[model samples]
Target: MATTTAPTTESLSDAVRRQSMAEAHTIQAMVDYRDAEMARTALIESSLRRKIERSAIALTIGEATGMSEARIQLRLSIADRVRDKTPQVWEAFVDGIIDFSRVRDISATIEKLHREESVARLENRVVGYAADHTGTELRQWLRRFVQRVEADLAVERADAARKDRHVAVAHGDDSMSWLNAYLPSHEAAAIEARLRKEARKPADPDDDRTVAQREADLLVGWCTDSDAATSAIDANIAVTVGADVLAGATPGFAESTDGCWAVPAPWLADVVATGGTFWHRIVVDPVSDDVLAHEYVGRFAPDTLAVALQFLHGVCQAPGCMVPAERCDLDHRIPHPAGPTTGDNMGPLCRRHHNLKGHGLLHWSTSPPAELIVIELYPPTPAVEMEYVAA
Candidate 1:
């Protein structure tokens, strides 16, 4: 038998690998270009919105309508954001391609039209209308179009209300505590029996009911007679990690898969150092187990975590605040024990920034593995003195 050939650098595999690497680089460059372009567009649009607020209101009949300057400013603000999509669809409304009786938010309608149809259709409609309509006439027609859209939306809301009912039940005590009393045991038992009957039925392929709806209905039955397995789910986990890849880089927090976003372990030096940091609590979606929002409580340790606070937050990260890292908290950009605790995923936050992040006033959106750079400063403060001095 002939000896089997061993792979060598000269084989076709080397060429294919080089080509794949080239393609990946090209794709990354394109993504970077697109992001830069989006940033530029956003800046331009912001400037235009400010200009419209200053000038557009002057053209409107505000005094007769009793619309305050602030109200006019607000409308223009909304208009400016929607202008790009609105102008393109203005002709569609005038020509009756879009049913004015059913549409709302002309900008949103235009966007849908373009996406559902084609850019060619949008371009053609605008060109055809531009030849016949004046800018002032177009604006007037759009105002009426918006009114029809609102009426249609109201009809939709009413229809949905007739289809599904939302019942809010108050659950008292901590989340880990057993389900609170709602109605009498007999009433609860009756509801549970009905839920089981629905759960037992085979799934209907043609049924309009969503998977979420089916799961929700099943969940009602699950609430009855809790077991060890059910109790384990009741204890949600939380974890803290840094925003950067390396540990102790940028502090942040995220909830664990279980939906519990715990405070960083007090034993972790970073957690103990940030005096102003606190336990940010949140009730997550039971099904998705995603955090909804943070409810903050002061729970920081003034020692131990000092070095981590210094490392992650050189200063306060809030937009306008300028507090130092020493006074800040070690915030898990993603939070821990509840979520992944990585070095680069952390952020240092002063009291002001901590409040902002907890309240959703300021948000931390992460990028992919390599380009996870912070746009805003963490613990916005003056540069700290380097710990080691050259001899």
Candidate 2:
């Protein structure tokens, strides 16, 4: 009590590790509690006599929890599925080795198998993997694994799913509307790629709209305005495929610059066979995965530099913003005339952030060697300072 000593390094490290394990255990316990609640909700919903009554249960749950009815229903479905078919995954969740997100992934993957034995097999294979990997990685692994295990059923399932595709619009506050589409991965990816490519076109110097705004405008124009839609459809999208894959020598996925989606080899072959247009081919060093050369494969001259930058950054360079670089304006870190239009000085910025920089509300500069952008943001009125680094 008279003289307290600082904790030893070994003791501090041990304490931190113990604390992390305790937090993980607490998270696992919370997930178990949620599963129990969801199971009870599902049991009650199942006992309801009418469909309307079941839906009302979801509505009540949503209202009480501040979640959408869709989310509540999804959780209930996962709980019922885990209780009925995939108890192994539930046990893993209960054991504190995996979290609810991984449980959801496993449940969803198992549901897609459509056979009891297949579901069991997939659950056995994926539960341990989920414990070791992030949810995103688990999903990617599951997709490839499912395709490998059920190649014969994949096409049939895809066709059935395709029949469910539809578009809808939901109104939001401030006169904004959200347009949603449930479409096949390839078609949706292609549409997004095209939209992003169109959005990257150079605009008038005075144009103040952000890349997102421009993309929304482009989508609306394409849908409702015939001329604009035709022109936009005429533009090409860049699909990155391995040379061996494109030549059918090896099977692989065709990916876009943003990496949001990957088209399966068979589907990609079909698209190419059925009047899919080719644009520019950008070859990369296979080992390094760095762009090496660009060759025009179609009549239009693609913006090679823009494509390179988009691939390198993938999203807006502005800190904390995730606008796809394909849908952003490539800005010179230094003014274009002041700084040469070179890779070292160029970066993508969405319209809003670009305008903010132009108006002197924000300032940024590129650092050499690492090619990191150091940004200092100054908010108005009370005046707040924030700094971020983008690499």
Which has the greatest lDDT? 2
TM-score of each: 0.20, 0.49
Model 2 weakest lDDT span, ten residues long: 382-391
Query: Residue 111, candidate 1: how far off, in angstroms?
Result: 77
Using TM-score as the measure, which candidate wins?
Answer: 2
lDDT of 1 by residue, 152-267 (tens): 34334334543553445665667633334433222233344444445445677797766556645456546565331122121111232322311333222232223222122222
The TM-score between candidate 1 and the true structure equals 0.20
Candidate 1, poorest ten consecutive residues by summed lDDT: 228-237
Error of 2 at 353 (Å): 45
lDDT of 2 by residue, 120-201 (tens): 7887788789877767888887876565456447656766777899999999999998999998776776677778877778
Q: Tell how far residue 83 is off in model 1, in angstroms.
A: 95
